[model samples]
Target chain A: MSKTKNFAVVLSAVVLVCCGALILGQKVNAAGEGKITGTVKLDGTAPHMKGIDMGKDPFCSKAHATDPGKMETYVVGSGGGLENVVLYITEGLTGPAASQTATTEPVFDQKNCMYTPHVLALDVDQKFKVTTSDQTTHNIHPLPNPMTGNIPWNQSQPPGAAPVEKSWKAPEVIPVQCNIHPWMHGWFVVVKGPYATSDSNGAYTINNVPPGSYTVTAWHEAAGTQTQKVTVAAGGSGSANFTFKAK
Target chain B: MQRNNLRKWSSVFGAAAVVAFAMPSSAQQTKYDFETRMNIESHVGNITGHAKDAKPDYRRYCVGCHGELGDGNGENFPWVDPKPRNFQLGVFKCRSTPTGTLPTDQDLFDSIGRGFDRSNMPQWSTFTKQERTDLVAWVKHFSPRWVGEKPGTPITIPPEPEVTPERIKAGREVFARVQCWKCHGVLGQGDGPSAATLTDDLGRPIAPFNFAEGARPKCGDTDKDIYRIFMTGLDGTPMPSFADNIKPDEAWDLVFYLRTLMSQHSKEKAMAKQLGLKPVDPNAPAGQQ
Candidate 1:
């Protein structure tokens, strides 16, 4: 395995193998597949939510620093900015059922009144295209439980229309609240695999996965769940990380 | 000179842990080194009135607030708006099994070894069931990372039943006569020897987790998220909850020596070699996302 460890294992298998990353002798339903890339890194540290009166808001005194509501760095070290966090891939991950030139799901957005992505992970089935640019109205809750409870859908985005898509069968973690902005929250992890989405710098990637044995999870609507365990060694490539603790 | 008297008693214990994390919390109120379990029959686990039997100083009197090494931090954990409790992300708000499931090791040993009287964490039966199975194997040793540069420690080693071969060489001599090699080093590998001066809560350093970098931490091989981490102790960090004093087959042989101290590292082998693909094993499950 030399030639620089086979190009350091082919540049960590093409910049972190995605598309359901699998590979041991190749057979999770192998057809020349295996992938998962990484990068959901927001640098680190930012918690800020504890009885947030933040002296009665301005986006809670610019994303809050203290009023018993601490958690700085809306800028320093860089924390929370990318609104719709949906790094998807459902069970054995390869891709499909996201038609629209290969965009099966995950594009949910809302820009400002909070929820630009307090974290949203996806995988099972797909379909979730929400949109709102803001003029108020808000409320598009989607709190899935009973593993996707008949896809517990909700809507209200109002403002400028044209962005509503929906779909999800099971997996869990969807609590997209905004009863007209009761602190406008968000979270939607679902996961099965073939994931990515971590910007404003947290970084994420998941592609073409076919190799197998996964347990790769990393979630954070507020900050929780950060699993790991990957093998994908047929054509070979693997690396996983998730740190969240800075609320 | 035990290394200059343990480096002057770890620089006076790192200036008393940075003056107990710079005081406040109403003047530094926290301490539960281990021991809490109450009488043993004040609960029954969600049948309404009989479920509180796991307490063991829940990893120093209940993990900071109620997180997985009981989940709650990230500075102060967005101040707990129904957040906190990563019981290795099994998820629970007070379950019967419907809000996304995952709560029964008796509904997490009766809501953290029986306490919840309006919550922020209380009632840790006086500690035992082996300090709530050593604070449920130190709240599944807060997710083991580190691979080669060495990491994955505090300890999550459960799973050793069957015995023989002189009790698996006396359980590797009860794992170095239970110093677990001073914070799991030698081979359980989180770098032990007190892991080159630990650190975390922002001091940095912090290293441990190295079962050959294969980390898959939900930190629960099950048994009700390892008995709700030996009956609740992850409210914040140092991880302590052995639910009265270990048992349930010694919390499953300390979760198989903390899953052999997770040889550490595997965000799906670093996102399958960072997008280039093919290292995949993630325990052999197939692909589909």
Candidate 2:
């Protein structure tokens, strides 16, 4: 009974301490642009998708134990496209953030019959040129849009594949699938933001943000959402790090 | 004592009965998460710990409806319209191709994360993805028929046909020859010859007019749509794909003919059934009735 009482008291104390720290932390932070970056990890229960038949495709056939591409995975890397993992301001949220519709061409390659960039982020009203690096035929199937219901866009990119890009003029979580292989899927996240994608090393830097009190949020395709207050001084890069837990 | 004997006989004959399994897990497997492909460690890790966690979840959110074993017959079974899925039985509908085969992880994910647009199944996206993932895995554990085969098989498909008008017309002629107009209604309204007799995965009659109808099934909504339908019959019901009888070209023609049926009843029946007013004439025939 005494141990139980002690455990209850300790739990209550921990809660109060966390709440107190949150309040003090919010008040002490001054306004400015802070950098937020960290590895977007996949921590929860993964799907029971059986191992794909590597048949004869070499790249996907085999690789290192940790090479995400080899594991029949959808890792949040350059290959994942970093789409829809929304990183925005959470608490201490202040003035609006910078944004734009840059119609840049992000390559959605199907090298060796796999959807490169398992996740990707794009600007709204922007046209993204997507092309396959594989010799197999591919189809760009954007979700939620009835217009391109399967997009009526299908083509084959032959070996030594010359780049054949398709533009996504509208914003959507379009899943670009290979007509050759049905299970292959990749995501295209389209948004209007002063947003920057995390690099291959799980790093992201959004430049030119005006100084203000913002709760920067980092979204990961698997680890879930992460939010923290960040202050950016004029023309200065503030520092912030987000850590996610895999349940 | 009699009940004990009933259990043994029951499992032998009605082993897959709808009322014998547990309620479905709220978490569904959707499109393969590109980020979190499976690791055997995670599979084993979760399985080791899943049983303990599964009990409470089943009791609190599922038992009242899905039954102790996930057979879709809890105490509240009478109230649910389409009844919860009988996981033990493993009959699933609404697959991309209409075949009632074992559901893909993504298919289950779609059902859990994004509740059916028109059904009573509620979306459990509010639950953590891990929770959802664990739940789906645990549900798969409910049935041991697939232990060694591995999970989530890739969906194979037919070769694409040339989408020219001539091919489309030729496809239509083949469609007529197959008498597809019978149950899917002449208009593809799913009211074809076998339409009225067709019961969905949940035991409800289903009509097949599917060109832009309420919500298109997960499979494509194109000529390829017909191809898959023809290849694998929709699971849980009478809609089998024609892979056995029709060639790819003929399947395409069936699709073209089906498209004509799509426009036939693509609108919602906003007028609630004025059931009391002039009951439909029985035996009057499909079109006239």
Candidate 3:
């Protein structure tokens, strides 16, 4: 009976060791994950963004009566900081690190007849939301090339309507627009790996990237895209700064 | 005449060569691949549809409008106003399924029979049922989507309630709540504020359906058809599905209210007339309808 007990104890210890190693393996992966940070700036004089005429919709015009709305084609901040630029690691990411879908949902709002955060970056298959805060009706239409495997969809959100939750099946730079307000335009930048969008200050940080050398790409709606090579050490961060010339 | 015919033949071959070379390799559908796709099949009721069977019929009738590639770039493409549907995209209006999803085989079959009103596509009711089903299969084979994905589940439609004055009033409220007037005018005249600026997915200018014009909707004319139209939405157009915001019971009410906007006489229209219903004031604050 004592011999049998000893054998059982040995087997249990072996199993526990395997479990501990597996847990440690996962923890090591999490600990080894780093981040990429960057700032995107406009190199030359900022182009003139045309003023939008919201006179067609009485509700929209009234909301922007005080400070007239202008097209967001190029929203350059102080110091030539470019806003609404999406950056992502386009190369070197593979396996779980590349295919991981974000769990946290991002909100894309329609406020004052304009899209809040004009460009939303998302990991492929990450759930995102479309919400309308304005009083008037807005139809949220995202046109993704069907050939790319991401289908296009259109939905209306009247005042007080519930939010619509959706996710992209593939990586694409889908254009989102409000048909009711033609001037209302935005983009959904979907990539397979971790991504980030530059804020008003042209600052962005892409987290959860495993240590590796990668080619990071930064895309702007009007100015097009730029890429730079970056390398992150274990538990350290890499950086790639982009400068787009004003067209 | 012989020299002219020879030149025409050469030009046709030249154009074909240009098309083959110019298109992106990813989008190209080689003749061999297209022929292999003929094996694709669709099931409608108990009838089986084979894409191979519809080739001759498509060449005879559909090739003039739908094109050889099913890209809707046929010889008549330039003259047609609202352009033929690009089947390569697999995005269709009048789907029983929700927006962004493929329509069921039955939906495609029904559309073949319904024949869009005010459109060049004539009613194919003259064709045998088998021919129509085969055509549906042929349509499916054009897009690679059919091979990878199944049709979306059709939305469940509750049994339509009898039309009553209260229902009509409630339907009007539903219409106002959803702000259908943003595109389809308050009076459903297709002259809403945004109507002039409306465009399809292809960026082509498209006009919203004017109920007051006395023309049947491009989808269908029955009460159920009306219900499906708003619930599923006419994809590829400015019209969007209200399924997310609308409850099934409320959707029926909106359908009844939409009927009153049409010039045709109906129970809902008669009840609306008796009630002396006025158009919802677009200026009224939301929920005041």
Per-model tally of clashing residue pairs: 191, 67, 0
> Highest lDDT among the candidates is held by which one?
3
Worst 10 residues of 1 chain A by lDDT: A93-102
Provide the lowest-lDDT 10-residue window in model 3 chain A.
A17-26
* Model 2 residue A23 distance off true place after TM-score fit, in angstroms: 82
What i-RMS does every model get?
27.5, 21.7, 21.8
Candidate 2 lDDT tens digits, B132-217: 65566545555432333233343466576544455544555555444454444444445433344444434365455444365554
TM-score of each: 0.23, 0.36, 0.89
lDDT by residue for model 3 (A98-197), tens = 5456788999999999999788998888999898898888999999999788898889898888999999988899998989899999999988878888
lDDT (CA) per prediction: 0.43, 0.48, 0.87
Ranking by TM-score: 3, 2, 1
User: Alpha carbon lDDT of residue A167, candidate 2?
Assistant: 47
| TM-score (0 to 1) of chain B for each candidate | 0.24, 0.58, 0.88
RMSD of each: 28.4, 23.7, 13.6
What digit string (tens of lDDT, one per residue) describes model 3 on residues B1-289?
Answer: 6545545554555565445334433343434365568898989999999999999999999989899999999999998877888999999998889888999999999999988899899999988999999999999989978866778889999998988889899999988878888888999999888899988999999999999989999999988998889888788888888888889998888899999999998888889989999999888886787
The runs of at least 3 residues in candidate 3 whose Cα sits more than 4 Å from the true structure, single-residue gaps closed, are A1-27, B1-36
Query: Looking at model 2, what is the TM-score of chain A?
Result: 0.60
Q: Which window of ten consecutive residues has the lowest lDDT sum in model 2 chain B?
A: B266-275
> What DockQ values do the models have?
0.01, 0.01, 0.20
